[model samples]
Target chain A: MSNDIIDGILEAIRLLFTFDRELWGIIEVSFRVSLTSTFLAALVALPIGSFIGLREFRGKKTLSNLINTFMGFPPVVMGLIIYLLLSRSGPLGSLGLLYSTSAMIFAQFFLAVPIITGTAKAAIESVDPTLKETILSLGASERQLWWELIKDSKKSIIAGFLVAFGQAISEVGAVMIVGGNIRWETRTFTTSIVLNTRMGEFGMAIALGVLLISIAFIVNYGLTRLQARGG
Target chain B: MNLLKVSNLYKEYYKEDKSSINVLSGINFSINKGECFVIIGPNGSGKTTLLRILGLLEPPTKGQILYYNEDLCNISRYKKVQYRRKFSFVRQKPIVRNTSVFNNIAYGLRVRGMKWEEYINDVNDIIKLVDLKGLEKKNARSLSGGEMQRVAIAMNFVFSPDLYLLDEVSANLDPMNVKLLDDFITKIKQDKEKTIIMSTHDPLEAIKFGDRIAVLNNGQITQLGTPNEIFTAPKDEFTALFVGYENILSGTAEMDLKSGLTIIKINNLTIVASEQVEGEVKVCIRPESIGISKNPPSNVSYRNNFKGNIEDIRDLGNTCHLIINCQSERFLATITKLSLNNLELAINSEIFINFKATDVKIL
Candidate 1:
């Protein structure tokens, strides 16, 4: 068993060094789906989060609590919901996006939106109250006030974005259910790892696992550097 | 003409449970153009709230705030923004941005759409004015408390607003910073076109900085007058105590037919006051106004003199506060440290305490 593990490791390293085409394609698809979803999620979440964080309204607490609840939503349950929505007999069946990259992007976007919103809201809320007062006292216009507030909390907002990207990149159940893990078109690093492992392709499975972890590491490192620069 | 007039101003803060707290009530004051109006009050006395309302940062629950003849509350949003640019407020605790001191000080000018090249000299001059010249490029957040306050003042001063509302801006500063701030205020006061309305709990600050001082206590202006009037003759007991009048003696006063002075009898001592009054009266005399001499000098102009033994001597840095027990009536007297040493005063030592009848204010 130890020899098998050692040989599998060696084979994985060889495959990685050789830049296996099929494996890199899966990785590329994973990044494409995750990056697109993260971008789409930020577009919706940043403003919503800022509004929720900065403004006081009648139902703000209820809305904040609802977002917090959504942040903890189960991935598999979200996948099931997306699967039902994209199924042939479902309401959006005419769009024919089922088992497509767009469907996978949609699934991941759903997973990431709440994460980004919750984090960004928390980030903006943590800003010093006196900073707001000081900015207002300085005769900052409405637009200038919002811009300064966002800039003041930029570090946390960037961290929130990184968190959303991390969630999207690592998410498996939602994308697998929506994308159907088609070989070259829709297959991702996580789903392909599962497939290789199931098919006794241990070398390829280990190689993809290492690649996934490396990607996560690189992304987190980059985010930490950005946060440090902001600090 | 009055630069800002606030009439019947009231502010109420409502809690989440629907309970409300009246922070300021019936607050009325009009600041004249180019006059330094200082509001003196203790903590939670609505000094900050009043200033915030005057700064146009918050609206009064009920009142009219008029700039010249125009009511501020009735103005449109664009007009309000335009009017807000006319004044600058420096809060009690200096708020610094997480950026360079230069950027922090330049924020007001930048927000007003002034280009860097146009306002850079002005910003640099303000930096020097606040004595933060060398640290302009340093991070504002990394500075010491005094340095941050200088930055806060420079930030406000860079705009050179027509009206300045400062809320205890020097409350937390060191002596050097306080002096620097006082100098800045004096320099600004020289500009006859500028109007300043500041608040402080310090009696010395009020006396030094105010053209007219407003004593605020419990959300109301207790007394509004020149600093000399407030300090020398506070209208009420609260104002007297707040202005550092340590000896607040209550007694029954009656007009002395022969002397033409009011004689107030308290405990075992008969005190003479300038005001001719009858019935119950509260008289206050400042500790510094009382004379402490080892020997009773003859033919002094002071109307009230008493023989007392030193009850307690408190060494207060540059001065000593001697508690004189004159025939069971205790009186506080502040004397110079040199005098304290020269007299070699100790507990139970007999001393002569004298104060003028005019110094005794009957409230």
Candidate 2:
């Protein structure tokens, strides 16, 4: 195990410097999949979160509870559900999107949306109600107030997106199941680590694991700093 | 026409457990243009809630709020925003953005889409007017409570809104800063002649600054009149006690036709009052209005002079409170301790309480 780990580190370092075409292809696909999923989730989550944060309604608690419950739903369960829907003999099977990067991206997007929306909603909702009243009393239109709330909560919203991004990029169960872990195609950093470990490429597996942890650390540190400043 | 008129306003809060509580019930008032109307009440008297409703920050549960005879509730959504811009609210706690003091004051003007040069000029003028000099670029969040309140006052005053709504803006201020706020309000009243409506719990503030004072209790207006009228002729027992703990004594009136003076008998003590009110009534006399002496004066022919035993002596700064037990009644009078010492007055010391008949008012 020790030898394999050393070898994985050396091979990962070599791959980083060589600009190997295959390595580039995998890295590009990972970025494309993760960034696209996070961006799409953010676009939908922002207004949803703002609306949930700003307004009160009859079913507001029920809606918030439902979203919070979804925040904890297992990714594997979601993957299985999607796989069944898009697999052959299933409802969307004819589209041929199962086991493709599109399928993997879709799975990650679904996993990420609730995290972004839930965290964003919490951040925006915690703003002092007096702030909202002051802005409105200054003759701010509804759209202007929405923009002001968003601006005031920019740090939290960014943190929310980063959390969603971290969640999407590090996920394996859903992406692997939906993408079929195809080489140089749908294998994200996490899926590649799993696949390389299974194939006895311990050096590459350990290297990818360390890289993922480093990325997660930097993102979280930056987020915490912003949160402290905003607070 | 009144600039703002609220009729039958009510607000209810429904809790999470679905139990409803009525916070403000059937509140009604009207303020004409350029009037410095103020409301004074104790905590939880719905002053802030009323201010919020007037500012259009929240809708009253049921009522008609009219602006220039146009029903605010009947206005279109877009027009509501248009009409709302006429008034501005300045909260007591001063919700300033985490930005420079200049920027905090400039934010309202910026949102109004004014030119940068014009906005800067207005911000400077407001800062100077509020006497916050040489601190324009300081971070607002780092400011002291008094400075923040001053900045808030300047921010709202700069806009020169048609109506200004302030909620206990002087509650946390020191005496000097309270005077600054008082002067600021007076200047606004004299210069702009803008309609100002504010809520304060301080009686002195109501007496000194308010043109007309409205007393609120249990979400309803208990009394509304000039400060002197409300202070002198409070309509109810609650208002009397609230205005000040001026001594209240129950009495029966007896008219002396020859002297044309009414004598009130509270158990055994007889007090003379100028007002010829008949039958049973309550008389209120401020402690300061009555005088105290160690011995009954030999020369003065005062209509009201009573020999009594000193029951309690309370020293408050330069003034000493002497509660005298005259027969079956207790009369509270304010006197200096110098007199207490000159008379060698102590607890249960014999003394005389004297005052003019006009000092007492039969309520």
Candidate 3:
């Protein structure tokens, strides 16, 4: 609508096509921390999620309720919690992780794990109960049975991971509070977008947003193909 | 030795209202190795519960399942799985995984730790055996109901467990699929050491597959014996009516010592039975025992003859089930299709039906 807006749009496209080093650096950090945190979260979340979903035991209801509460937990609060734990003179201060990429990873890991666990539990719960009987009737052991269940819930669990990745990659509050958004060290897509917008560098922020979305699209497109072929 | 001795098994399910409904009560039977043991009953008669308990899918609420004289009632879940490896259970509904038919059939082998090379041919052979050779690559869930049932049977059959627990596998299948499954089951039964415990509500399937038949009703086993023994000599009124191929008529009985037989009077009709049961009695006569002739069967001294008219002619493939009305009394007589053709008997055809005194059972 305005000359300045038009110029910003043109600049955003130019920055993307020219492959700006600053923009790529931000993309690299974003993917590195988010991917690492998502991967680590899945490792811990999957077993806990599957165990809670499949078994009937004492305190199952309370456990499920607690995980569900964590699923909707605010990311800023998670950041504050990790900040306090890693801050100097706090309980876990000896590691000197605060204001580092590792501190950012800790905050994001706490934020991502609960979402993945909740989705994994729900996915496992939705598998056909009769299929479990069929698996056991084949003389499958308890481990084999759970493996079959996990395989059955593969699509939903992967979808949950994608959601967790999305949340971690676009995160600002947690990484900012913990890593201080130090450029070339802890600055990721969301924190960089926040800083660039504050400085009236809207074109760069918008370009980074487009690239993040394009990456999400590519991952989903690949998984869609995989889901179709799997059937 | 008995492969399994189920002694006084019971199962109950509690509803949301906290009231318990009994599914099985004091069920008792012993199955020998290689025997085709069939538990036949009406729907809701505890057949499924009994089969599920036998397969170790569920524990009995009371009593014991002695597997080879070792009580399995209190075994650990791990131990139960070890024992389950010795058996294969084909559920009533044909439930399959959302995978290739080949994988579904190979499932048992995979769980048993058999390599793909070791089980591939066995799976292929079973696919061919169940008439699903080319469909192995097809997704199992995409198949038709009949095809699903075939895959379900092949899934269990490929591994050849020591015991087979089939719970109404042919209950809702098409005739073609049922025949294929029945043929495959017959082949399995041919192995003299592979025990099979099949449950069904179909009397024909019971007669066809059972080496020993147990008739369950109202959560209890009313009768258990060879098909012949169970059919000919059902001990109670429930069994007599359940397996009603035999025409059971309530009548007043008088011991006729002069003729060395008991006389049963039904309505205005009189029948003679070899037994000496007195007072109110049930006169049981197998349809096959009754003879149909154009003329009265003469000089058959022990025979009871009646002049009747064929009221309904039911063509049962090779055998014809004829309902004859003799002076307002009805009788079910089964004659061969060839005999019906030779006698030119149709509905309303005049005929004489005769059953010897020994053919009738006084219960």
- Interface root-mean-square deviation, each candidate: 1.3, 1.6, 1.2
DockQ of 1: 0.46
Q: Tens digits of per-residue lDDT for model 1 on A46-101?
A: 88888788777899889989999998788778888988988999988788999999
What would the per-residue lDDT of candidate 3 be over residues B201-278, giving only the tens digit for each residue? 887677767778899998999999877567645678788678767565667999887878888999888998888888
lDDT accuracy of residue B11 in candidate 2: 93
The candidates' DockQ values read 0.46, 0.39, 0.63
What's the lDDT for residue B45 in model 3?
97
Worst ten in a row by lDDT for model 1 chain A: A222-231
Q: Highest DockQ, which number?
A: 3
Ranking by DockQ: 3, 1, 2
**What docking grade does candidate 3 earn?**
medium
Native contacts present in each candidate (fraction): 0.62, 0.51, 0.71
lDDT per residue as tens, model 2, B169-276: 888888777887777777777754588899989776676566688999989999998765676456787886788745566679999999999989888878899999
In model 2, which residue pairs have backbone atoms overlapping below 3 Å? A8-A203, A8-A204
Q: What are the per-residue Cα lDDT tens digits for candidate 3 across A11-108?
A: 89999899989888888888889999999999999998987888778998998899989887888888899989999987999999999888888888
